[model samples]
Target: MSKEIRKFCHGAAVAAMVGLTALSASAEVSLNVATVDAAGTLRNLAGNRLHTLLREQDAGVQVRHIEGPVLGNAAQVRDQVAEGSVDIIGTDIAWAAPYSNFLKATSFSFVFRDQEHLAGVLDSAMMAELIDEIAAEQGVRILGAAVLPSRAFFTKVTPQRAADFEGLKIRSPQLDNWLESYKAIGANPTPVNWNEVFLALQTGLVDGAHGLPVDVQPNNWHKAAPNVTDLEDMFGVHVWMINETRWSGMSSADQATLVAAIDEVDAWMTATAEAESLSTIASLLDQGGGVFITHNAAKREAVAALAGADKVVAFPEDEREAMRNKALAAGKALEGQATWWAPGVLDELQSVR
Candidate 1:
């Protein structure tokens, strides 16, 4: 979503949203929601679904889903929401780092047992309130849950052994979660912007790529880095936000109704994305794009061992320990509330806890 020049639909955006500053009780509550992904993308579909759910909250609630660069890039939308110009927007959790310490803890290696484990922690009421309390200061409130699913690695050359990734340049975001993971695997981590990822891979600036399958599919990264050896190093979660002023204007009954609907939409979106992501790999191969490199039990063990043995280089040892402890405690607390977990995911959660 961040890779190219923005084409904002200025007039179209303004047309879609009905401003809500001073509305009569006879009028509906208007939500001006924005997303950076184009229509048909997972997050966009999720946002659209969110719109449908919000309207169902009450006859008084109405939603407008303005997508793409119509609201500027994701960062601009964040600012607009803070200033109360936009009512809602969706973005990655990286944006929440400064808002919550628990979010900072998400970067630690092995913090999540698996995809569902990661979702469980993020959807828990504790984390939800923590994010809301922190972000409320900025005039934005965390609305609900969003899972971008887990991220994987792909390369131009296949790695037969785990250590084969050593010294290779792997493209990732500049966050410690990504940089330190690749460094632990012995790769030279290259921080690259989202839009420039295709260029880096095609030009060989980076030998391997890291991102969710949904992310790389539309960007056509599979064509450049064709050897996909799955290594789910971390969870890719998104943060849903709404302007605090808008939320505050609503009555208590209205707020409760909207929150419940948002939570339901979040669960549906996460499940849909998970199913679609699994199908993306097959389509990539059908299109003559990449071979799936299977990492057998031994190779998988080797990868786990490497990450487990990875030293705390990006963060101070004491801070790393604190993050891990907080992360685990958060996960443990969410175990019971993970009703949306896929089959057998709870068992995995048990092992992690």
Candidate 2:
């Protein structure tokens, strides 16, 4: 234990500590995020928020965004995420049906009455189970479900009654089940991509396009067709997912930070989507010069006949009936309130809480 030897050993220990600290600081992670929405669209909002949150949570981590068709459409992005070609993707549940049957539960016609019902299901244990199954089977992680408004029809020819849809050439996603539903309604369902929808309508390639008012208004779909129908048939659910391998490779601290950030963003997205729905409908009517058609009960029943009521419950038949009874006890939660900024919305949002 000479003084010189003691000094040298102490210096060596200090140097090792410094080196380890530097190594940890120098670690860098990069992730690629893909989405079908154009830049600045609500679909891209979640992606952008995620990128910001990641950077704020970890300066060493970097996220890159790919919008439009760069990574292909939403359906293509799902495959890319599963194959690890893309590190992350914002996708629709309808497109993920091929990979997971749990999605079929959400796909069931009229499963949800409005945005609140849809949000309730997404925040429920059922959606968590579905996400976990997808993660295990497809090798991708579901961050959260991004909300959107209920989908309705925007047609060139005004349909006062559901019978008017007969023989109409309507543009819809090429999913066979979806097309079959439209066919059941007596309309000729033409499958077309979102990018091709405008031209399809303008050129008379299709007579109508189906989507949410918020989705259709932003895209200026009403300019091509003047009539908007409030069928309230379907709503949009965008699932944010990341490649499991990449997520697993991250440090424990980074993984926690990423998940927490996504949870916060999901909460914000739900409220934003609810607010946007009303403004979107107004914009379509006033700015886009479209006529809004409110269907009567008989007409709605006709549309329902075409939409068909198919339920997918995870429980046995007896248990399913019991669950339905429980849901009925909840009973018409949003009844008699059709507009946003209504009195019961905050309570409805809280009920799901």
Candidate 3:
């Protein structure tokens, strides 16, 4: 429903109107694509890029973009894919967690400090192992992954110090890891879905929000709750995936086309995210928005204290801690490396036995 998506959809419709329909006939296979985010977001960026590359390769693949609720909500879209009704989807890691722990590993405490660290660690051998594990267990084929902007803290009531959160009700996703993450970070977390966020802040159902720039800027939440704290505690993570049955049904040539197209999208996304994150944050502030708080070492430390505390609500608390510890160890090993941007962290995450 965003202006950009509307424009694309309109242009496609217009192209058909003008008798450009012959070009689409070259498609040997066509697939449906959907994303929950608006057009300008990283999710849609990946979606748009895939659509172009697949077509350019005349990969015989026609991709249709179904953005926002046109197809369904996140849960419904994912369910459709699992049922083999929806061909492909672009979804963030948090929403994909019910599928497997591999999807949520990116969200584990401090696993990724910034987009650079995220790009670095995700490009590792360890991540490959997890991706295949999830595919085997969950019956989905992960085409590729991309790093979203880091989720930071934004509040209406500027905290003079960390203790000011006595009654603070910051909003987070309904997912348990996010709930625990917000609680662990020292604020009263109010579980809310993405759609309700703007109104939640507008009417004071919540005090502030903890999400990435796309979440805030697209909805104009900056007009309501203006102060931002750059904790950079977690990177928003998303994966491009297809149902396993559909994936296996495709010809190897078609499959190869998808892999190549997705690789191109991933490369473009990594660079664009690094360039866009800061400027997007500042764009919100330039037009009569709110104040940007310098980084708060104390609040970050407070959140770091709870890392691997066994408090994750998604799985057994004990099990969650063990999972987090593994991620923390791997993440710690990756810190301050100049090799963060190097490609091919692993070609194909090792296959599952």
Candidate 4:
């Protein structure tokens, strides 16, 4: 929704909620939510689902999902929430990492074994304590986190082996850990804004883009970079953050209601992400846009024996491990630089089953 419409609706809600609260003090609570993705995408769906679930649990809770670029990018809207102008924001964990060392640790590659492992760590009491720390220090609290599919390269030229990626410019966000990890894998990691990635790929500003199928398919980046090399290295986590002050001022009952709604939506995202990714690839293939590449030795050899095998080659598993190690090392190194980092947090995460 546009900011003008949101303001009008919020103003209307205030008067209606005032009457409801007069009847019962805890009768209503209103939340102004922000998200960077456009309406109807998975990210937006999660926010809209939260609104539905919240209203079902408590009829008087008001939620306005302000879709972007109505507000700005993820970083800009996150500032809005921290400043208390917006109640909640849906953003990537990586975008929020600069504010919280614990979040920075989670943003690195190979930190979790897989989707189930990531989910377990996020749902644990340890993570809850870390989030509380963010609220206490950074003014924003992560309510819940959900996984997206594993990320890899969507390249103009299919990389037949790990060596093929060497010295090639790969587009990624300008983040220390991500840049360092890609460097370890031998790619000359290039920083590019997400919105500008299509132009970057089309103009050969970067030889390939790094992201998931869902991310590339919607933007038709696959049309520019038709080869998808599924290194299956790391997954993306979408986090819901709320302003700590706003949360603290809310009635305990209202806080519980919002948390319950987020919990359900997190579950839904985790359950559906994998299927959505597969469906995305199927559609990409049907549209003559994607050529899936795998790293399994047998599959690689089998595809290589075919007529156009170069389009379906593999990235060495050893290279993927090297990237993972570099990311873990980078995450560990943060403890010395950031005073708020807990020494054993990385160990604790790895220890989770």
Residue lDDT tens for model 4, 1-353: 22211111011011211212222336577899887775556777788888778777665566888865587777788889999988899877787777654556555656777777776655543454455556778898777677777776788777766577788898878777677557756788999877788899999999998876776666677888887777656677888888988777776556656666776787787677676765565555555455667665654454344424443556667766766676567666665564335665666667768
**Per-residue lDDT of candidate 2, residues 1-353 (tens digit):** 22211111011011111212222324677888887876656767777887887777665667887776777777778778888999978766677666543343344334456667766655543344445455677887677666676666777787655466778998877665466446645578899998778889899999998876666765777888856776444677776678877766776545555566666777677678777765565556565455555433443343334332120001133432333333333322322333212233223433443
Q: Residue-wise lDDT of candidate 1 within 1-353, one digit each (tens)?
A: 11000110011111112332433455567888887765666677777887877766455677788976677767677889889899988767665554543354354344566677666555433343344454457877776656656676677876655456778898866666456555655678898776678889999999988776776777777888865565444667665778877877875545555666666776776777677665665555445355554323443344334332221012233433443454444344443342211233323433432
- Look at candidate 2 and tell me the lDDT of residue 114: 64
Query: What TM-score does candidate 1 get on C-alpha atoms?
Result: 0.70
Listing every candidate in turn, what is its Cα RMSD in Å to the true structure after a full C-alpha superposition? 12.2, 16.0, 13.3, 8.7
Clashing pairs in 3: 28-60, 123-345, 128-349
In candidate 4, which residue pairs clash?
none
Full-model lDDT, candidate 4: 0.68
Give candidate 1 regions above 4 Å deviation. Answer: 1-26, 55-58, 70-72, 107-109, 123-125, 174-177, 294-352
Q: Residue 335: error of model 4 in Å?
A: 5.9
Q: For model 3, how does the per-residue alpha-carbon lDDT over 1-353 read when each residue is reduced to its tens digit?
A: 22211111011011111211222233378888888776576777678878878777667666877877677777778888878888888887676666543334356454444566666555543444344454567766566666766675667876544455455898877665566555544567897767678789989999998777755677667777876656455777667778877666666556666666766777687667666656666666554255554354443343234321121111133333443354455444433344221122211111111
- Among these predictions, the greatest TM-score belongs to 4
Q: Give the clash count for each candidate.
A: 1, 0, 3, 0
Q: What TM-score would each prediction reach against the true structure?
A: 0.70, 0.72, 0.72, 0.81
Ranking by TM-score: 4, 3, 2, 1
Which pairs clash inside model 1? Answer: 3-195
